[model samples]
Target: MSGSVNMDMFGTPLQKLFSLMQLTLVIAGLMGLVLLLWLLFRALMPKKGQTKRGRKGK
Candidate 1:
């Protein structure tokens, strides 16, 4: 059971992979935060005018 595990990558590649993962997570989190802010802003603010694409009472 002691010699049953093996991994190929050791130092540099693993560090690079971890860095890449961190960067990707940061970017995704920022994108999600921006999307949430945009949605909240749209939901909380009053509409200024009738949308040209409105089809409700046409």
Candidate 2:
């Protein structure tokens, strides 16, 4: 292979900035998705039964 390397592969500053923004957006989206799933799980769970009269020992 030739020793010459393509400088274009390094990309421009603007391109790099855009890629960073995209990565940030993806991470934020995943976090929001996890939060939504957790909320749904909590909502679907059954609540524990409690006696209205008070403690049975009393």
lDDT for each candidate structure: 0.66, 0.63
Query: lDDT by residue for model 2 over 1-58, one digit each (tens)?
Result: 2222223323567666776798899999999999999897556543434434334423
* Per-model TM-score versus the true fold: 0.59, 0.60
Off by over 4 Å in 1: 1-11, 49-58
Error of 2 at 8 (Å): 4.8
Error of 1 at 55 (Å): 29
lDDT of 1 by residue, 1-58 (tens): 3233213323468766876798899999999999999997677553635544444533
Q: What TM-score does structure 2 among the candidates reach? A: 0.60
Among these predictions, the greatest TM-score belongs to 2
